[model samples]
Target: MDNQKRTMNTDAVISIRDLRISFGEYHVLRGVDLDLYQGENLVVLGRSGTGKSVLIKILVGLLKADAGTISAFGQRVDTMSKKELDDLRLKIGFSFQNSALYDSMTVRENLEFPLVRNARNLSRGDIDRAVEEALENVGLSQTINQMPSELSGGQRKRIGIARTLILKPDVMLYDEPTAGLDPITCIDINNLINEVKERYNTSSIVITHDLTCAKAVGDRVAMLFDGQFQRVGTFDEVFDTDDERVQQFYHYNFVE
Candidate 1:
């Protein structure tokens, strides 16, 4: 693509250039570059403790990169003021590695919390409509009154997804959406991720170790290893590549 065309086509939902992150002496990310385009689902795959979660934290401003440029929605995120960060956050939805629901609230209340806290201009009726829409989107319209303790693992994940959807964020970051679920629930969540993209035209970055889940949701995949992106390509290209480390990791985790 030409420079102008590339710029227009990119209009990237999130951009990271030369990103480097460290926790004291341990560097988690090293000069990584990535661009998430509008309405695309990009999965970052890596083994345990490979900085997948930290990458997402950097995008959302929960953790700062030691050195890098992070731009979200065309604004530089790394240097954003607190107000700007909060504004940016409101446009991005995050589903934590754990569901991170409040035990004190029922599913209905949990879904409404963001709308109540951040969407103060919305009327009571508008909030209710948004909550119902979010629940319906995640196939949880009937579980509105259920508390966190009353739900199954899969149900909690779905509820968390619903909460994320309530904001209708332009970009959604999912951290291990199906980590501990049953095989059937894992597939269900994967399908739900696809559905969310189709329904809302939302862009996403999924952090996952599940190769099956990765293939299900990703239009393209990038392997993160040794604090950098080892390789990135379409599922077919990356998975079927002849590189020894890529082949070895896939065979070790996926092939019996």
Candidate 2:
């Protein structure tokens, strides 16, 4: 896909400034600032325990920030009420690290669960259509009746994405989408991420340690170190920097 042509209307869908979060004196995020623009993928690269997951949790309002301002779609997330936050979450899709599909549910059932809960007003026919469309988006329409256990890692990841897509979210938050998958499967997942961006025209934040995944899916890349962004730029711009720390983190030699 031609990302240059796809890039239109540079508007910020999500913005964070001076964001600070701490857990019992241990600071996870310290004065972090980020902006996720519409129709673009912003990949955050960081080692484990650098608060990537915590950042997403705060964005979704799962965890409160100690200090900072977070605004999504022009509304202040930090100041929103529980009801408002819950309503806002519907517009955001979160793909967890493990795919997080319920083992007891079939693929169809899993896809339907979100619609049944969030889209209560939809008719049965609408719900079925939504499920089918979501599955077809991920190219998994045939696995409708299959259980989560019967699917491969890649398949489960696709189902997880389908479940998220069922809501037709305006923003997507992906936490380690390529984790625990084989290299080939990782590439497939990365391709799907790109496809989703083009198809939905949604803004996305992809948190990952995998550089290949970052390069494949991210329109812009941000590196998190010491509770702040060490650098932010296009993949090549950041990767080609002269900073030793950045080079060391990316395993400089391996990236080429």
lDDT for each candidate structure: 0.89, 0.90
**Count of backbone collisions within predicted model 2:** 0
Encode model 1's per-residue lDDT on 17-55: one tens digit a residue. Answer: 778998989988987778899999999999888899999
Clashing pairs in 1: none
lDDT value for model 1: 0.89
Q: What is the lDDT of candidate 2?
A: 0.90
Tell me which residue pairs clash in candidate 2: none
After TM-score superposition, the amount by which residue 214's alpha carbon in candidate 1 deviates from its true location, in angstroms, is 0.8
Q: Please give the range of 10 consecutive residues that has the lowest summed lDDT in model 1.
A: 1-10
1-256: candidate 2 lDDT, tens digit per residue: 2434233223679988878998997898998888888899999999999999999989999889999888899888999998999899999999988899999999999999988999889999999999999999999999999999999989999999999999999999999999889999999999999999999988999999899999899999999998988789999999787887888877853656
Kindly provide the TM-score of model 1 when superposed on the true structure, using C-alpha atoms: 0.94
Model 2: how far residue 225 lies from native, Å = 0.2
